[model samples]
Target chain A: MPIYEKHDYPLVDVRRYLEPGPVVLLSSAHNGETDIMTMGWHMMMEFTPALVGCIISPANHSHELVRASGECVINVPTLELANQMVDIGNSTGTRIDKFKEFGLTPQKGTVVSAPMIGECFASFECKLANGKMIDEMGFFVWKVIKAHVDKTVTAPKTLHYRGGGEFMVAGDSLDLSARFKPEML
Target chain B: MPIYEKHDYPLVDVRRYLEPGPVVLLSSAHNGETDIMTMGWHMMMEFTPALVGCIISPANHSHELVRASGECVINVPTLELANQMVDIGNSTGTRIDKFKEFGLTPQKGTVVSAPMIGECFASFECKLANGKMIDEMGFFVWKVIKAHVDKTVTAPKTLHYRGGGEFMVAGDSLDLSARFKPEML
Candidate 1:
């Protein structure tokens, strides 16, 4: 369905629904071309071997780049860089150079051919263990080989998604028992 | 290895990151008792079969619960329901009646025995996909068997996580062109 009239089902943009950490714009060099796209659509899924998952569509420019490069970086962004995030999300590499347009720093990562954004708070250098995609919504399954983070600022006080062109930084954390029960912290 | 202290590393509560569609409180019902906890740790790993990745600790009361049940009801929630989200996060089913105490309504799911939350916006019935996890952060890998979003709340806005004790909600979606570029959209 190209467009549903009246959207009689939940049709919220999923991009806005994901706001866990600084969303890293994954920059990948594939077939001699580089493309980056904002992703909050990633997660850690398993424990025995530390498996992680992220979704991307086959049509996405980054999809081809990642496949060619066989890897990508999960950059964690801060709220100070939300505008850049928006720009990356809004623009596409096929039309314009996202690096030049957004002025994001592209640095070489340790393990993967995909470069990491130096501006991100952290980076996860990931390898494509396997991939499966849904036709209606493009989602990618991934596995993480190595990951890293920065804690210069309060790391946990990061981005939160609010629907409708809205985003919220985390409110001050309250220890449930300490604040409410007066016994546990 | 036991106590991972964040020196200059980004540390976050994994529970706080799941952008809320379903706060899948998966657990194992053992010995005729139930133990359930909230999960915002899941993300779409794949699009085709809808593979998901999430974190569950061996020490968590719900850990053993997952081992026993091997199935779960991904109870969807809303921003107005944030308090309930935290309520389940804080109170462990290990010692108390989590469902009754939280005023949760359990409805029969089409695929899984784990009851769906009637009040929430969506439900994804899931089964365990046996897989290995990463070594650094022990997590779990699973797949969604079926999903049910409330047909009544088409385009329902809601909240989700980035870091800390915060949650984010869905926002208005822009034209596909606005989100991407002319070429990709």
Candidate 2:
């Protein structure tokens, strides 16, 4: 007999488990003001041109900034930044500058006005691909224009946010390349 | 010294490491024909309405089916289904029935025309929310109408697709719920 007893469960809090990802810091700037918000709800939408989609509720300060400027930088931090990510994510950027408070230096990006977090292992400068659905769905599609990474750490430990302040770090690198098509790789 | 070094890397392949998530089977049906495609590029866009977004390249057979049918099912499978997930992903559905060829059992969903894979641990019946950007971005936004999970395997082993055919299974569950606000959780 199969060990799985599948059934419909309460959808109320299941998202806490369904939303799996490494937390990243999203930096946005508009009208001479800049802010950083730790975000986990995001996804890669396309391979070539590297389109990305994320939800930033209007309630967030970064939402208006990103909408007005039409750009943002996605900074992928390592596991070491987990606690700080949580701290930044939980706090609001309404009154204070997260960069100064969190001790993260902001560096200018190649294509977008948003600054990249100097402390992050990698950063993707993105230009908004589509913002029409922001009002209805809170969805923002970004096309990555420039990318950067810290190559020294070939085996980088990235942090995946599990709801309720818990996180899962990238563990092992398994090779299944032989099984996939070259185009997919 | 922080030991973290940052540098500009090629933009082409960073997504291979940056996009992280568990492998899922995306099911779509149109005109009485059903098809399944393995996907890793997906994200939770909202909480209350349970919105999800994924990319289905126009090249993929399910793209038109999902667009025309206006619905699809996001089936979360366990690690045991990794090989099959990969096999289905590597092949096309233009000429063959993936369900019969792969020996997967399909069950009817509650709110959507897309059938749920019986073997999966969890399934989310989703209706296409927005398709205006499908032609330009190949992005499909879906609202999850019903969700089902296998309760027996409380600690279900889910597979995360690592680029180049590699996969990562979720590890330990850490509880940081105490630190987060109730609303955010």
Candidate 3:
């Protein structure tokens, strides 16, 4: 396992790690209880306020924790953490401490109580920006207040889930900056 | 470009192609005018109804067309269409007919008036399920009524956009189905 020395990253630019649709580990804490859940259904909603929208099924243990505390950390796990990611999703937080069982180091966040997974290369601290659709759609809009990313890893081999326990690993990057309009970039 | 012989696909399983967060081409038509736009901010919201949530800025020409018609087609394009995808995003549909300008074949959808890009490997016909968040957040919830996929292309080399005109191409797939619980799979 690689030691990820993460540093403070711009909140507005968190989309660079998130927009590509990598499966993320959502860590939440409330009343001294902590949980981690694998989340694949999420999208970047805004740039300035750094908003994100995701579906957290009420059936998950982390749902209650996040709803009660109104905060969570979105951790981007690379291919190296694939096993731990699947294990976290398969297991339940109600039964055991995920951080301890999975052997993941939980570091305290700067703004939120949810601990960021130290093994992950990038972690974004988020607060619930809107919960209006939670009841109807199991949807939560989050505002990323603080972001931490390991600048050493330029092209992180993130995992993108494709149902049935299959994942598409991040691959070659194409720099099409010259093709884009100045304002568009 | 490879000719895609797409066939009818299960609506509930559309998440297999979408969950990975690939850049998609959104095609819409209203009042005999059609437009195509590159969309990166989207996610699968549900399985049963095959719901998908996406952010389409009001400034985009397709927004008005989709809002008025309440229909659109989510087309998944492979690396072959990278140039076209960036071109679509950088250019606007307001001035010219995107289908003709980009030389993309437009096929009439079965359920909706919106035309699906014939060149893309897959296309999902969608109906606006919820427009409540459109005014405030440029959010649109769509219910996929029909799906068409090209069965030959097993692992699609889809493009995942990062900021600054950089894209991470879809790479090697890892099958961890054996690790998953039967119910989870």
lDDT of each: 0.54, 0.71, 0.94
lDDT for each residue of candidate 3 in A111-153, tens digit (9 for 90 to 100): 9999999999999999999998999999999999999999998
Q: Candidate 2 chain A, which ten residues in sequence have the lowest lDDT sum?
A: A1-10
Write down the C-alpha DockQ for each prediction.
0.13, 0.24, 0.92
Error of 3 at B49 (Å): 0.6
lDDT of 2 by residue, B52-125 (tens): 77888888899889999999988777767877788888887485788898888878887788888888866777
Candidate 2 vs 3: which has more DockQ:
3
Better of 1 and 2 by TM-score: 2
- TM-score winner: 3
Using lDDT as the measure, what is the rank order of every candidate, best first? 3, 2, 1
Number of residue pairs clashing in candidate 3, backbone atoms closer than 3 angstroms, sequence gap of 3 or more or interchain: 0
